[model samples]
Target chain A: MKSIKILERLLAAIPIMIGVAILVFLFVRLTPGDPVDLMMGSAGSVSQQEIQALQEEFDLDKPLHVQLYIFLKDVVRGDLGDSFTQREPVTDIIGRALPATIELAFGAAFFAVLFAIPIGVYSAVKQNSITDRLSMAFSFLGISMPAFWFGIILIIVFGVKLGWLPISGRLDYGFNFPSVTGLYLIDTVLARDWPALKNAVLHLILPSIALGMQLLAVLARVTRSSMLEVLRQDYVTLARAKGLREFIVIVKHALRNALIPTITVLGIQIGVLLGGNMIIETVFAWPGLGRLAVDSIFSRDFPLIQGVVMIYAFTYVIANLVVDVLYTYINPKITL
Target chain B: MLEIKNLAMAFETERGLVRAVNKVDLSVAEGEVMGIVGESGCGKSVTLLNILGLVPHPGKVLSGEIMFQGEDLLKKSKKEMRDIRGKDIAMIFQDPMTTLNPVFRIGEQIRESMRIHGLFKDVKGGFFKSARKHAEKDRAVELMEEVGIPSPETRYHNFPHEFSGGMQQRALIAIGLSCKPKLLLADEPTTALDVTIQAQILALMQKINQEHGAGIILVTHDLGVAAEFCHKIAVMYAGRIVEQGRTEQVMDNPHHPYTQGLLRSIPKMSSKKDRIEPIPGGVPDLAELKEECAFYPRCAKAHDKCLSQEVPMFDAGEGHTVRCYLYG
Candidate 1:
């Protein structure tokens, strides 16, 4: 029954994906810059014949409808076309960059959840205490502060000032390790390379923190308020009356009920992170899909841009689906 | 088995310190069923919570010694109180729909009390912890059966939402009886249930009391329920018990004006009166309560002395007592 529901949801994503593809195809074209102009702008002397020939080479001279039709036709056959700038297959580029973004996202999500739940539960349990007030204040700052700016500050303090960590990139330039998973963290672990794993972790800390700060803040506040409401419920009082330890009451009884809302925020955050943290990726100079998308946008690489957007849309659909499934586990009352 | 002496609980609200339960004195012996009846906010539920040491935050025990079994519950540390709760003294809350955690299976919740207190810890299962767990589960199923829940085996796996209101209450009773506590504190356990269901739940509780010999302190607003279910009745008004005695004695010969008004308010089936006389005026504001009788304004027998001084409980006869100037 659950699988059938999931299948129906998957089927529903088809039209949405097509709609996104159409919108992205048109929207990218609607942008001011032409790919031919962008590619030839750097060349000092460029003639109309050279531009026309380049346009013809990329099949960009075709009418908008004809181009859309060709693009849709090729997409139906599992082809995303090639990037206008890199002249590489869009799928190949995305596949290569995807693992990097996933690694960063995993790290950020890990950091967010690790700190958010405890902070939220504690603040709720000791409501109006000094610790609650201080944590809440910090969370407010976290939610409001810009991730890019925070990323910069972290780089300056941890990288430039203290010089305790690498300032940019995922790993040291000279340290060559075979890329098994492309996610350096896991690849290093799989290879039993401790030095590489340590280096990967060190590089991950600042970017992950900078990216995860806002999510952590939002999650903590949500968890705290949700927990506060749950704790006041009759069941909590009853759980206490049942002689269950405070820990069991809070964790097993209270936390599970409280997590429903937190899971919602977490799901949306995960979707956003998976879509790619464009600014954070740029700041850290991380080789992730967000950076790829940003570069493609600048170069008017329409196919690459469309591909990234499609992946993002797909990720959001899957994230929401996972959240819905998780709801059934967290609260039996909520049917899938 | 349980004796609460001068138990006064106050909630620190935004307005001020509002006395919720003031100078409440009550006791329940082994196998006795005591009912504390009052309108909403009269602190009947608070007194029950006070006994279990589960009064919510901002509600402080102003001055009290809830002596249970022999020791004062108020003097017990939080950890000690937890050990006593559900093991020696279990509580069945009102609104079964919300009392049981919705996420957990009904059987898991029923077994939770035993698991917490390690009821089957002595089971001989060296390197086989599943044997102890199995014993616990079997006991939970037995409790479910004892509470009259249909098909204890399958229903045990169902969540709270799956159960009907009556079934939920039954499950809650099952949870209360799981640990076989010496005392049970039922806070309006059947208030949310329908009339028929209420009677069934009450009967189930009475049976549990008879079989297990656990003393019960039931808090309720229904006078009829108190009359039918309790051996001893304590009627509360404005956070204080105005009258208490054997159920039949209080029912037949009420002393307090508030108690008389309450008795008059109950629609009698055999009476020719078209309308029951409701006690006029709402309960007094606890925060602004003066040193006079809290029910003075609403009392038909109010006098100069009733307004001038605080009233004390006067012995009427037998174990009967009433807090009124007329008695004084």
Candidate 2:
């Protein structure tokens, strides 16, 4: 039964990767730049002679399919090619950036779930009260205001005005924690450096908040509405009629049923996290794949752009697979 | 051993007040099965719910008290009510589909209240004594045995859905008997079963009465079923009991016009009761029936006195009471 579900989930992941490849391929072609312009420049300063030589050398002079085939071939061989601007391999740049982005995602997810579920549960349980109304109001505000604006407001208030912490950047000037693993939290803890750990967490705070606030609202509201519906099921009344305490009735009986719908909604919200990386990565100047993709798009760097989009697609497909497995865990009906 | 005094109930809905149960005074002797028989909307179920404290919210028991073993139930707090609810008084509800939790096994659901009320008293100091735990399981197994379940020991792990209708009722009976409650409020308990199962269940109830000596308040819409099972029968119409008497007396000498209609409606085996006339017209809405006996509109014997006010109970015979102007 478990294996069949896993097989379905594995099958479901294929389409997203196909979508990512298709989108990157078409969009890369749609944007007006070849490897010639990327290798040289748009201005007459580079001269036509140099641009022609560069295009031929990089196999950009070939047909679209051939160029695509060559790119795919190199990609399979772990060749991300060189970044003309950075004067380094695009692979190295993304490899360095991916860890920081992963750390932020984890930190944001932890805080959002921790804050949202309890608030949602409490609001649902205490419904129509001041706490419920206030929590709802906050959710609206979180979802409405743009992440960049929220990020800016957080920086102005906590960073510039109070002079408590740095406004941007991931770490202090000279503090070097050895990157045993790429995540800041793990490395900071390993180096036995409390202050770097503190600053790293602090730096992630505003951007993660800006990125995660919308999801928190979405998750909490979905949870509250779902719980309110589940509360009316006959099983819940039966549990109450069983002479169980109110806490047990709400927690054990109502919440478990409520979580099934909430899991589907949470999965969608987490999937939307990739969109946040676009705005958040640029705002904080955090070195991550989102910034790399944005930068690559502007330069029309095919290899780098394809790789970055693939990561987002890969993470998203895997998140959905995890959600399916999670649904099975919460409700046994979904199994084979 | 049970006396229900002047029970009144009203449901506060978005519309005005809807009277559900009203000023019902009833008594049940030790081991006697008293049935409140009525058509739907006659408040038969609500009166039993008022006795069991299972009436849904927004439907309030507006006045009166229920005295069980000479102690009034309305005075007890919700916590104290819990102590009496499933322990001292257990109920087998009408819909077998919903009475048991779908998620839990039959044995666990049945054993829950027993372990709550009976066995835990010995292990109250935050520690489980081996003998107390042993006794809890022993008593639960005995209850399943008493209910005549096939292979009670092996069937302990099965869920409610796994049981057939008759088996489910037996499981419910097992749960009801687990705490050895003083009163069993069975609201149409066998109404959902087939004829054969109904007979078996009725027989089981009689066996339970013989063995345990607990007062059983059986509610059913079927007059014949009531006559067969109950020691005393109360004929309710439009939220009031129009006639009540010992089963033999009520069956043989029904006085109220509505009772006469109901008795005649039953296709009886008795020779004199051959010409069956189905009761004409439906039960009048209790909430809309203003300033008169609720059943008067349909009562063939209703007069000017019936229109003026509600009829009070009049003694007709030995332990017989009929609420009608003709009887008065």
* TM-scores of the models, in the order given: 0.97, 0.83
Off by over 4 Å in 2: A1-4, A11-23, A35-39, A52-59, A70-112, A115-151, A156-209, A274-277, A284-289, B52-54, B99-111, B118-177, B190-214, B250-253, B262-291
Worst 10 residues of 2 chain A by lDDT: A234-243
For candidate 1, lDDT tens digit of each residue in A34-125? 89888887765798899999898778999999999999988878789998888889999998988888889989999999999999999999
Best by lDDT: 1
Candidate 2 to native Cα RMSD, angstroms: 4.4
> Best by DockQ, which number?
1
lDDT of 2 by residue, A217-248 (tens): 87789889988877766556545544566687
Error of 1 at A284 (Å): 0.7
Report how closely model 1 matches the true complex, as a DockQ value.
0.87
Inter-residue clash pairs, candidate 2: none
Off by over 4 Å in 1: A42-44, A47-49, B126-128
Candidate 2 C-alpha error for residue B90, in Å:
2.6
Interface RMSD of each: 0.7, 3.0
Which ten-residue region of model 1 chain B has the weakest summed lDDT?
B121-130
